[model samples]
Target chain A: MSTWTSDAAALRSTWFLRGVRAAFSLPGLILVSSFIGFAALAKDAGVTMAQAAFMTGTVWALPSMVVLVGAIGSGAALPAAMFAVTLSAIRLMPMVMALAPEMRTGKTRQCVLYLLAHFVAVTSWVLAMERLKRVPPPMRTTYYAGLGGTLVTTNVIVVTVVYAVADALPSAVSAALLMLTPMYFLTSLWGSARERAGHVAMVLGLVLGPVFHIVLPQIDLLVAGLIGGTVAYGLQLWRRKVRAA
Target chain B: MFILVAGFAATDIWRFLGVYLGGKLSEDSDLLVLVRTMATALVAAVIGNLIVFPGGALAHTSLDLRIAAAALGFVGYLVSGKRMVVGIATAESLLLAGLYLNF
Candidate 1:
């Protein structure tokens, strides 16, 4: 019985390796590119290399980190930076909801799942959700683990490369690399939206940010996001009510 | 950097909260839908902010180029039947090419 249990554990680990490979495929590109961008941002912002890597490992949310750094650089209060980052991470709530069902099985699996959730990024979450149906249930967790693990490792590597080449590289190249982070994120989310309200929310945000930035630069993103998301949610609720009626 | 790290750590507190809460929910409830839509909207808002009022290097490029690249990439993603990799590569490639030309 002990030998059988050991064999089962080994098999699970091996399967996890395969799952990681499958999950890592295209999703890895997104993480790697984003890390390069993060590196550039760190360099331009005067953040140390260790600090950047630490941020990636800890915060793991690029945009929010950027906002936090920007806020600090501009001497914004620490509480404000915390609030902004927390607000930025609000999107992860649903992603966790969606992914949790796929990851959690038994108690031990739940522990692993919780650790795996830390690695969830925009790219891997989408890929995992979309591709999970093709995979067996038990292996889904392993695959997600693999994909996210590769991304975390790649993030460190990319950031290191960017830091190494920061002074040597041309400004244009650094700039282009940095843009890839947001570009990849925006494009990925834009591509994956399935609901009309989601699309509308995006459009509203796109239109409102610039308008608000020109008029109320201090809180354009925060205000636009609140207004846009609230409006979309309200519209969706109304539509549902009408349909029910 | 210190603040950003602390800020991120704070953000992650929510992820941990999610794990605890997620262990006890149905995947297809109305509440879930509400959560999904709210999250989607926030993501949309962030994307919009990036494109429309970019800071840093993206601010150097023409708004037209950014719009065109994003549109082209989005359409490509749709045309390619919602393949995320295809969409991301398409948009990034277009923007890079456009940036190169302008420079």
Candidate 2:
């Protein structure tokens, strides 16, 4: 029993530390810079540093926080702001769904999964999906907890500090910093894709996103994802059938 | 306060639902594949929108420059054995150089 307890303790710390180490990587830097930009934006919108940090921690998703800040900045009503934030956040559902199965094991408790689910935003999702395949299933949850927990805590501190000290960042500098996120996402997705259909879906979404934005502004992302993903999956199915036949 | 309540609920409901639903399905199920694809596409769309029609500081850069940086970054990423840091550095460096040089 003593040996078993020590073994479990060792496993938990090792996996958790691995996750924490991963948080200092490129994705982590990108997450930090993005929030620095966010802090400036929040300050400009007259959001208090406390509020900005709160939103960073609670809302977690950058895009949703942006919408919330924009709504408050514009003096929009509460329900309107809530609706906009909710709509912007709908994308997280599929991301969480994709990640949950990767982290769950038969012995994993439902409540533990729920706690980890709070960290399933874009960067964490991408990082976890990329790395989780190498992790033992039982340790994946612990790994994600460390990664996500470190990211959120670090960003909260960064936002609060940057908010208090920095003048507005130079447009060029801030723009370049902001560009890191999409650039990271694009490269990571391209490199880490498990199948050709993933690539096809990415390309289709890339093309369709802008088109839908022009044609249908509000639900552009939803429409693009549904159509692009379906079409790409259909193509994959067809290819499989052809190979079999 | 309202931001807290609305934002948390609005964003987190999906996460909770995902966990609940994902718990029910096996990892390699066809339905998970669909969900993964949709998620990938959604993120791709977000990247596309951010690049094509950016807000705040990113909007200050020319569209051509943004596209060029992203394209080159992708190439750099591919050529460098998919090192994410290399891609991001190459892109950020190109973007800053372009901005400074008025390219």
Candidate 3:
């Protein structure tokens, strides 16, 4: 009983420290940068600053928010807008996989994970994976919780600022801000490409994207990612087999 | 915009769902591996689409211009030992320069 109680306390404390670390990490910076784009989109679309702020607090996903604002601004149908957002968000399923492992212990901790998953994002997931791999399993959950909480706070603050100033920015600045969204994703991929397969996947994605677009515009990204990622994965497996033989 | 709203709702619903599901899923499940590959592929696809068949502001530039900028960014990333900011800045700078040349 004593051990159980101390273990719980230790878990809580470690998690708190992880949250503090999150407030000061690269993921925090990425979130802030991307929110700038979101604010610019909200401002340009004539969405009320308050509404925009509320969206960020709740949605917390930039691509979907961008699609939402863009659709509304362009007078696209609601279903179309929602579909776009959903399609962009399909990425979240994998994100859940990458992050769920960090919070695992037993059945009771599963409930806590469900509560914490709302905070998952590219930045938070990356940071959590990096930190959790080294820490003891008992402390990993607390670290993830702390990191996620810090990210939420940072996002809230950034969204507020961007929404407030949305109307005041020049066209060029607004455009640049919008570009930052994809730019961050692109750059982050560069950082993630440590392995040869990752490098090949990115290059193939980059090269094949435009070519496929010209031939079949509708299914371009899908084709490129499928073809590129498959090739990369297959090549890696093949090479491994050869190495073994 | 309704679509956008729905999209937002759909995505967030998943996010909220994540909070509940995070602890329940096994890390080493075959389902998880399939999901990871699919996600990676999707992102790769999106990036490919953006570069090859860009819409909005990116559409304004020529295909060559976009490709060049992306290449420059890739080279910068490699030369800088894989610094993300460097790769992004290189691409942005190249794109801006292409704009200046075209205009």
Candidate 4:
């Protein structure tokens, strides 16, 4: 019985450490580098380093943080900035929905899932979805907690340090670093897509994003996503019908 | 304080909702599929906007250079068996090279 108990404890630690270790991988490094750019942007927007670090910790979503910074830079009112950030964060809903089930087991508590859900932004979501299949069901939550906790802590530090020294970095270098986030997103989404509909949605969104930006600059992202995704879904349904026929 | 309140509410509410609803929903449900696709598209739109019409420092670079770098990076990603690091290295290198050479 003692041996069995020890084995279980060892297994748990191994899984949790595995998640922590993943925070040093390419995706994790990319996430940290993106925050370097965010720090620079925040500094340029006149946000204090403390506020930037606070946002990074509390907001946890890079895009939402970006939206908040943009809103602040433009001197947008509180309600408007909140709304914009909320809009950008709506994308996290599906991500959490998709991921929650993956990490949940029959014994997992709802509160535990709720706590873990706070870390369901782009990079964590992508990393968890890609790696969770390798984790046993009972240990998935622990693994995710390790990953999320490390990512949040590490990024907060990155923001703090980078914000303090941002003035010294060249515009070109910071721009190149900032560009890494989107490049990582595009490539990962393309690589991990489960179906043709996802590919279609991505391509349509990419094409329509710039077009809608010109036509309706304010709500361009939302409109492009709605139209692109719906059209992709419709095409998927049609293709299924054709195959069945 | 404002960032704390607004940022937390704006982002975490959906996550809480997802946790609540994820328990009841099936993975392959039609609603889930639609939501997933919409989310993916939304993210894609964000990526497109960032690359094509970037703000802050990225705005200093010309649009053509940014687009070319992204395209080449994507090609490199595909050719490298979808390795993310490879894509990032290609794009960052191309972008910096363009900036330095005044291309």
Top of the candidates by DockQ: 4
Q: After superposition, how far is residue B61 of candidate 1 from its true place, in Å?
A: 2.4
Model 4 has a DockQ score of: 0.63
Candidate topping TM-score: 4
Q: Per-residue lDDT for A128-186 in model 1, tens only?
A: 78877655566667767777787777777778877888778765565567566556666
User: Which of candidates 1 and 4 is the stronger one according to DockQ?
Assistant: 4
In CAPRI terms, model 1 is classed as: acceptable
Error of model 4, residue A114, in angstroms: 1.2
Indicate the docking level reached by candidate 4.
medium
Query: What DockQ would candidate 1 receive versus the native complex?
Result: 0.48
Reference contacts recovered by each candidate, as fractions? 0.42, 0.66, 0.38, 0.71
Clashes of 1: 2
Instruction: Give the range of the ten consecutive residues with the poorest summed lDDT in model 4 chain A.
Output: A1-10
- TM-scores of all models? 0.83, 0.76, 0.70, 0.85
In candidate 1 the C-alpha lDDT for residue B58 amounts to: 67
Output the number of the lDDT-best candidate.
4
Give the alpha carbon lDDT tens digit for every residue of A41-135 in model 4. Answer: 78767889989999998899987787687667667678877776776677677678889889777799989999999888778888898988777
Better model by DockQ: candidate 3 vs candidate 4: 4
Q: Report the TM-score measured on chain A for model 1.
A: 0.83
- Candidate 2 Cα lDDT to native: 0.80
lDDT of 2 by residue, A23-115 (tens): 998778877877876787677678999899999889898867866776687677787777756755765766777898888788989999999
Model 2 agreement with the true structure over B58-99: per-residue lDDT tens digits: 788899999999989888988999887888889899999999
TM-score of chain B of each: 0.76, 0.80, 0.74, 0.83
